[model samples]
Target: MRYLLYALTLLLSSSLLFFVQPMVAKMVTPVLGGSPAVWNTCMVFFQALLLGGYVYAHASTRWLGTRRQSLVHLAVMIVGVLFLPIGFEPPTDATSLENPALWLLGALFLGVGWPFFVISTSAPLLQKWFSTTDHPDAADPYHLYAASNVGSFFGLVAYPFLIEPRIGVQAQTTLWMICYVVLIAAVAGCALALWRSAEPEAAASEASPPAAVLPLSWGRRGRWVLWAFIPSSMMLAVTSFVTTDIAPVPMLWIPPLAIYLLSFVLVFARVEWFRSLPVFTLFPLTLLGLGAMLFVQLGSPLEWVAGIHFLGLLIISLVFHGLMAADRPATRHLTEFFCWMSVGGALGGVFNALLAPLIFDRLLDYPALLVIAALAFPPALYSRRAVQITLLIGAALAGYLVGRDVMIYLGLERSRELATLAAVALSLGIPTVIAFTRARVLTPALLSVPLLISTFYLGQPEGNELHAERSFFAANQVVKTPDGGYHKLYNGTTLHGVQAQDDEFRLVPLSYYYLTGPLGQLFEVLSKRPERHPFAVVGLGTGAIAAYTHRGQEADFFEIDQAIARIARDPRYFTYLEDCPGECEVILGDGRLQLAQMPDERYELIVLDAYSSTAIPVHLLTLEAVEMYLKKLTPDGILAFHISNRHLDLQPPLTRIAGELGLVVRGRDHWVDANDPVYNLYVDGSDWVMMAKNEEAFGAIIDHPSWHEYKPEPRLRVWTDDYANIFDAYILDF
Candidate 1:
């Protein structure tokens, strides 16, 4: 009966802890914008929460009696019941996006705070209870932890592949609530067993062993932390690097996290047979070395390697971690070991996710973590002093040769000078070894190779011309597609804008919905406007806005990317710069930042069509963003937003912004037949949002040749960088 209760408790705790991650994380994307940053940040928060709960359980056993501990947990559980079925309060107004941290905090408080707190504390609390009740027969509580993480792994994978696909968010929430109730009942059963156990106090005291003791010092504890931290943090940094550089898809966060959890499972499993030895031995050597090697080739094929490489690092890191766990001290020291490990984790998150971006332009965290890992794990010592010196010297020479050759291949140093530097580097290793064996000379020398490599990579700034540039988080590249049309590529998302005209290859606007239906009507009205039309194009994609330029007409553009700006404004790439020459001025920076810089500026038409596919620039739709547009536009400026998407509904967010700004917004859903002459040369199927300051502008659009009636859904809240929610808007089927 006790065993059954333990099994039930394990089932309940595992389900609660593991499943909430993906479910709540997906729910928060729309609120925080669907950037990979959100998911990474959520991981940091969850790990911190788990750490806190573990500390709480430790405190519970030390200060409170078992009966009192159960009563206290029961009361907390009751309080947590108030957060049943996991849901957050809907934002009340458009400004909600302005403060996303606050928004995230609120959602966490209401939706899962108490419940997560309870579940997090359960594994440790229950383990302590078992040790006390069963005395000598009680197994190590630490082994159960292996089961706990296994549960977490299942929960993480199950959500995206199963629960989310099978049920909508509402139904998923209901199922979670049912699971929570069952867990509470199981906990009550455990408490009943504790009360009814007939073991005499004296026998229990005599039979139960004293709390497990640590055989290590503070310094050793610190080493354990370094092991745990370097890998976990490196995994996260690699996740950011891969997603930011290779693909910005929503699911990209999964593999890195899954591999991270699986590492824990392999290291902690009761039996060693399940862990693969080859992976433990060979994969680490290759990954640690190759990961650093690839750091030298950022824009080449190395840029395209996905989470699989990250998975390799994870498995290798776990092999070391498993080796460490096998040698872990007594259970009494587990909390101390973990506390320091938590410190390393928190530092890693802060360093990689928060500090790295602010300090450097491109991703530097991954390389830094690699060097740290190498230092943390020095090569095995040789049996004899002379032999040790020889082995060290040989390793040094090989590393130098490999490092220099790799650097030359990556275009860091001139090829002609490679042989000279190679000779110099190799020659120094022998003398360096003699100098190092006599003292600590090799410490700084060994560290310099990676440091120099890191410095070289970081120094090679990504170009911001039409072809190349790197932003705070995303890498931008330009290419001529097979159709002979230019495209702007940000990560994996393609932005199709202007196509070269068939005859002379003149620039033509091929923006998704520009040639048909309601969008055509707006174009006609804007074309016929008496005044010279001034326009603001928020997202500069392949300089497509230049297609609308007319002789003797004045125009200006607002592009957030310096790279995109160069593409649109450079006369050689797009004719708009040549034809309209001096008619427009390009601004650079975040769209909102530049928009605020030009409060007195106005435009007759505004196109907010700049999207890098998988990522939606959330700041562009905030209430503040809407007001900026309203203030910057001529009263008659027609705002056209390209809203084509496979995963999200942007209209509601736009409508909410429009309503807040007192502007009327309409949408044009357009489809084109290539067989039709005028439409054939344009967008095949497009969706565009058309907004006007008031009824007069709306009337003008309606009177245009292609005007069509547009009705927008009311009450949709405006999205801001701080508070956008895409869970409801996600188009899962597509």
Candidate 2:
């Protein structure tokens, strides 16, 4: 009964720790414009707090007697309880897009930092407390760590599937507070067990058996830090890359984190799972496979790409964490062991989440950690001769591939497809052969070269006159097509906007905003109004919408990323903003927040085009946002939303919310004509929703056959500041 109490205490506390991270982050997303950096910043703060908790546990256990230790921890728990019902208080001052990472960090610390810090200490502190108890299982409390991570795993999974879908943030906070109270009771029970045990000296002597092993030296401590650091850094890097490049869907954030926690559980619970032959052999092969995938631009079918990356991350984490678990010190030094591990975790978070974005122009941290992970593995599997031979073969193969790529670029007769296939096969095949041979020394050198070459050469955008820029938000690239006919802007793998370079069509609205598309039709109808009213655009992707502005009208662009705004206005990359006849202004902040600050309705038409990849900013699509947009619009103004997403069908929710607000909604699905001379030059298929205060407000475009009344789904849930379920909006078939 006592052991079960200890288990429950650790489990509940750890669950709360993980659950609060995502829940509170979701609450704060709107304030920061839903940038991926918001999550990364939260990760840094959580890691730092986790390190602080571990240090507290170490100090309390090392200095205090068992009874005193329990009392001290109990006191901290009481203080933590005071911070219950976790919530965020939005900063009174407007959050700047210039340094959103810092702003988000401040918000998280101020809101939930105290409670989170207390809960983070529970796993290590409680396990240390269990060690001093008279219970039968107290001799080996490492199992409790596994139980804690299991709770963390479920906590992450439940947030998206159970909590967010079923309840609002306020209710989730209430439930979390209830759970925290239960944890406090469990913790108090553990303290009583410690107090009821034998006297302090005798209990200490029994709990800590004499050293069967020597004290851990600095070298061994360094190894523990390295082992923990690789997996920690890799987890964040994988999450950032997938969310930014593929989709920024909040649910996508869960898988990488779940894999990370599950790795800890498996390795700590059963080391044999990672010691087997299949696990060892596949680790290097997966590394090579991920490197190959990174080299090529595998557009569309994101599932396949996401799957391979997830698998690679899981395998790598298991190997490194398994090694750390295998080398763990005796129970007497457990708290110190965990303290060093937490230090590594905090360092990894800083490097990947905070430092990488500031120093590197791209996400070099992901591939960089892959190289470090390869090096961290033990080299005992290889003889000296085998190591030399593998390095020789790997070097030659890398040279040949680099030469082949250079030749292809120089217009050699070699087929590009065949050369690429050959390179990928050689990269994967070499690592597979080395792993089967059990040549461990060759593993690091052989695997790293391919990853480096892939990241530096093959992974880069292929074109002449290419320019790349990185901000706290995302990495942006402007590239001219190979034929020199067009210039394109890319946010990771997703194309943001494009422009024809030819003089005849240079100023025309191209890509999704072409004159024949729904956006174009929206402006055409707006042009019919007698007054030249002010226009507002949420996202300034190459400023393509600026082309629709007439001579007398004024346009204001609300762009969250300053780098993207600069790219759109610069003539070298695009000329939409510069060429527009109307007066143009750029507001650098979250569109909804900026619009809310406006004193009155002034804009004739407001366009919501701010999406990161296919992931719609859930905050911007909520009912409250729609209300804010309406408030900033003229009486008959229309709200246009670019809802063309590859992964989600947002129309149902938009229609449902507008209907409940008593607004008129219309939609158009514009498809491109292949036979049209300007097919790729200007228009692409797009889906857009236009809503207004009344049906008569859409008079100019109402009679057009292209426009259709948007029907609301009676069963669909309306999204708002307090409640939203993106899973309901997800297109499963896609």
Candidate 3:
């Protein structure tokens, strides 16, 4: 019963820690763009807080003694109750908008900072407290660490699959507050148990454990930090690659985090056989396979790529965490071990989330860390000279193929891409096989391959790149089309919008925003209708939609990224905004926030083109958001959403929301052939959905061949700010 009290406290506290992350992110969705940076910033804040908690635990246990520390912790817990039911209030200043990550960090701190700090202290502090108790399992309190992660894993998995689909974000916060109060009582119970059950000998052994221990050195501490750092960085990197680069599956970040927590669960659970597993052998081989896939597209299904990378992350995390777990110090140093681990974890977040964007033009941190992690595999595998000779011969053959491709790079863009693929294949495949055969002999060679490859681009993306910049929001690029006939804007790999470079076609909308596209078709209908106030565009992508506005008319483009706004206004990259026949202004803020302030402007048309790089701005798609948009529109105004995506079927949930709002929705799955007689249109396929109060609101476009009444499947549910299921909307294109 006494041990159960300790476990229960760990469970509730860790659950609160993990649950509040997504709940706060959901609250954050409206205030920020759908940037991966937002998630990482939140992680950095939580990780920093965790380190602070560990510091408090280590200091208090040394100064106040175990029994007295518990009394002090109880006081801290009671004071934390003042910050309940976390809420967000976004900043309105123009300067704060430039670097949203800084603003987001401050806002999250104010909302959940105190309660989270209290929760963070529980894991290590309780484990330390448990180690001094008379309970039989108290000697190895690491098992409680597993229990804490179980709570973490459960909370993370539960938010999307169970809590989010069923309850709203607002209610989730209230429930979280209630659970937090219960946790305080559980923690109080543990304190009473510790004070009552601690023996005289246990008190004397406070400074040292029963077992003999070596002196803790700086080198030993550094190793612990490195071990913890790899997994922390790998988890975020894998998430970015899988969702943005490989494929954007909704709720995809869960598996990597789940695996991360599970690594702790396996190691700290003290599963004896796990220690003997051949993780070092599996780590390099998995890296080899994933590196091949990363450099060369095999035309494999999305599931295949996702599966291999996920497997690599699992093996790599186990190897890193396993090393630190094996060297865990005596029970007396329990809190100290965790404190160092938190420091490493916090550093990893800072590197990937904050520093990497400032330092690199591309997401190069992932591959660079992989090479660093490979160096940690203990060199237990070796082979004879004969095996080494044979592997070297195989590597020579692969090099020959890579050279042949490189020789053809002067031919065309396709040839250059093929050459790059060959080089990567040689780098990843040959070294991987050679290392696995004689790991120690080729380990240095293996490390050099990825470092060289990741540091320089071999022209893999296949375009005449004109401009590139990395921001906390995302990596933005402006590149000329292969034909050199058009300029394109890209956020990561996803093309945001495009414009023809020719002076004759400069004002004409191209790509998905072309005259024949769904957005243009909606505009065609709007052009004939009585005009309302200037239309509002949620996403400002090269200002392509500005072409639709007539002379003397006005249009407002709400752009969240200041960098993107700058690009659209710059004549060198794109001239859509400059060529606008109407009065145009780019408002620098999140679309919803900017629109909320414009209560008097009754826009006749509102276009939601905010989705970039498959990062769905789910806050904009919910029932509450739709209601807000409707309120901002004229009596018969139209709400248009650019639903064009390669990985997600976004229309289903919107159809469900239409039913909930009792609004009429029409859609068009429009595609323009590149080889059309009017090829200069430079258009591509697009999907758009527009909703109105009734049939009369749409005018003549409703009866057009491209427009249809789109409906949702029976299982699809209306998305509100409180509840959304990306899984239901995820397209099984793989």
Candidate 4:
């Protein structure tokens, strides 16, 4: 009964710890304007707090008696419950966009900091408490840690699927408070068991075990930190890579994190589950596979790309975590072991989440960590001569590829594709041969040299020329078309906007903003009015919409990223802003917050084009946002939403919100023909939603065969500031 009580206590506390992360982050999205970086910043705070909790557990267990340890922990738990009803109240001064990360941290710390800190101490502290008891499971209390992680995994999965879809944020908070109360009772029960088992001899035996089999050394502690750090960093790096470069599905963070937690469960529950031999074998194969796909641009399906990266991350995590578990100290030093592990985890989070963004120009951290992971695993061969020879050969091959790339850049060679294929082959083949034949200590270094070179090759201009820049928001790139007639802007792998470079058609809007596109049609109808209408664009991507402004018109662009604004304004990269006939103003801040401060009905049209990399900013689509937009528009002004996302079906939510707001919503899907004269020059497929207060204003466009009135799905719930479920908005078939 005592063992069961301890198990339940740890499990419940772990579950709540994971559950509160996503819940609180979702609650605070509106305050931060829904940047993916917000989640990364939250992770840094959580990791730091976790390290603090581990330190507390270590100190209390080392100094206090068993009963005293339990009593102190119970007291802390009671104090933590005082801050319960978990929710964030945005700061009165949060409107400032000077440092959003720090503001977000402050909001999260005040809201759920104490509860999270108290729960973090549970697994290590309870495992120590159980070690002192006379229960049958006392000798090997590590399984309880596994049980704790099992709860964590389920808790994370539950938020997006079971809890979020069914309950509003308020109800979710209430449910969590109920669980916290139950966890308290379980903790008290464990304390009672500790008090009952306090016999003199048993206490003495528990207090001081037999002499240490092997004294703890600094070298061993350093190993513990290294093993823990690799996987922690990898988890964040993979999350950033996939969301920014692959697809920006908000829930993609879950899989890598869940796999990371499951690594701990598997290693602690049964070491045999992750054998070092097989893990080492599969590690190189998967690494080579990922490198090939990244460099070759084989155009593999998105699912396949996601699968390879995710599976590779899982395998790498298992190997590193399994190493840590194998070298764990005796139960007498368990808390100290966990404390150092937490320190390492916090360091990893700091490096990837905080330092990388400020210091590096691009995502150098992801590939840098890949090199570290290779070094973390054991070398396959250790021949001195073989190592030296392999290094020489690898360097020569890398040098040749670099020289060839330079030649291609200078227009001295027309074999760019041939050179790329050669580089890809060397990148994959060299790593495999080294892993198989002469796995030397410098194998990872040799492997890294080629892989880094491959990054430069893969990132080279596939068009006429390429220029890239990295900012706090994302990696931005401008590529001139092969014909040197158009320039395109990209955010990660997704195209944001395009402009023709030819003097004759330089003013034409290309890509999704083509003259015949949905946005184009709306602009045409609005332009028919005699008055010069003031327009506000929420996102300024190459300033494509600026081309539609007439001589008497003016457009104000609210762009969050200064790098994007700079790129759009530069005539060398794009001419839309410079070529515009009307006045243009760029406002740098969160679009929603900036718009709220504007005068009522200040604009004739407001376009919400801020969906970055297919990740919909949910805060901008809620009922509260719709009300705010309406307040900022003229009586008959239209609010246009570019809802062209591959993963989400956003039309239903817009339709539902429009119905509740007593507004008329119309939509059109524009698809250009391949044989059309302007297909690649100025047109692409697009879907847009236009909502307005006057139904008569939409009658002309709605009557066209291409446009239709949007209908709300009966089963879909209206999204508001208090509640939203994105799972319901996902397009499964896409």
Clashing pairs in 2: none
Instruction: Summing lDDT over every window of 10 consecutive residues in candidate 2, give the lowest-scoring window.
Output: 203-212
Quantify all predictions' global Cα lDDT against the true fold. 0.60, 0.78, 0.78, 0.77
Tell me the tens digit of each residue's lDDT in model 2 across 1-734.
87788788778888888998889889888877656677777888999999999999899888995679888877887887777777776655444446777877877887888888888998888888877766666766777898899999989888988888889988999999888888888888888877886533444424432231656899989988998898888989988888777666667777888899998888777446674445666666667667656655453477887887889999988887877776777777888989999988889889887888877777677777877876777776324444445444554555566577777666633345444555666545664565476545565776576676656653345466468877877788898987888999987666788988887888888888988678877787777778868989998898988888889788989887888988888898898888888888888787887878766678988999975353467899999889889998999889998887767778889999999899998899877778987674646778888999987778767778888888888987888888999877765433
Superposed on all Cα atoms, model 2 deviates from the true structure by an RMSD in Å of 3.8
Instruction: Provide the lowest-lDDT 10-residue window in model 1.
Output: 378-387
Tens-digit per-residue lDDT, 1-734, candidate 1: 67557645865687668788777876765444455556666666666676777677777766885667887887787777787878766564435534444456567766778788788777667766665565344444455556666777788788777776556667778888888887888888887787676543543443322223435777776776677777778778777766555554466577777777777767666666534454444433443344444544443343235534665567556755764565555544445445566566666666665566556555667666666764565334112343334334444644666667767756533532344354356446544564556443343344335334544454343332245444433445554444554443333334445555353445545646354445555666677767755677766656556656666655556554455566555655555555542365565544555655664546777778754454666556667677777777887777788777644567766777676666776676666666777653535467777778776776565555454445545644445533444443444233
What's the true lDDT of residue 203 in model 3?
A: 45
How far is 279's C-alpha from truth in model 1 (Å)?
A: 5.8
RMSD of each predicted structure: 9.9, 3.8, 3.5, 4.4
Model 4 lDDT on a 0 to 1 scale: 0.77
Ranking by TM-score: 3, 2, 4, 1
In angstroms, what RMSD does candidate 1 have relative to the true structure? 9.9
Candidate 2 achieves a global lDDT of 0.78
lDDT of 3 by residue, 1-734 (tens): 98777887898889888988877877886777567777778888989999999999999998998899999999998988888878888777556777777888889889999999989999899998988887777667777998999999899888888898788778898999899889989988998898898463664444443222666899889988988998998888777667666665546767888888888877777675443456555565555455545545332477777888788888888877877777777777888999999999999888888888888776666676776775655544322343344345435644664676667654556645545674657545864676566446566455446434543442244488888887777778899877888899888777888888889988988878878768777788788876546799999988999999988888999988888898899999999999889999998887887888887537888999975355788888888889889988888899999888877878889988998888898998876667786655567788888899988889888798768998666677778777877776766576
What's the C-alpha lDDT at position 175 in model 3?
A: 96
Q: Show where candidate 1 strays beyond 4 Å.
A: 1-4, 89-111, 135-137, 197-216, 273-280, 296-304, 334-338, 378-455, 464-734
Please state the error at residue 59 of candidate 1 in Å: 0.7
Candidate 3 local Cα displacement, residue 191, angstroms: 1.1
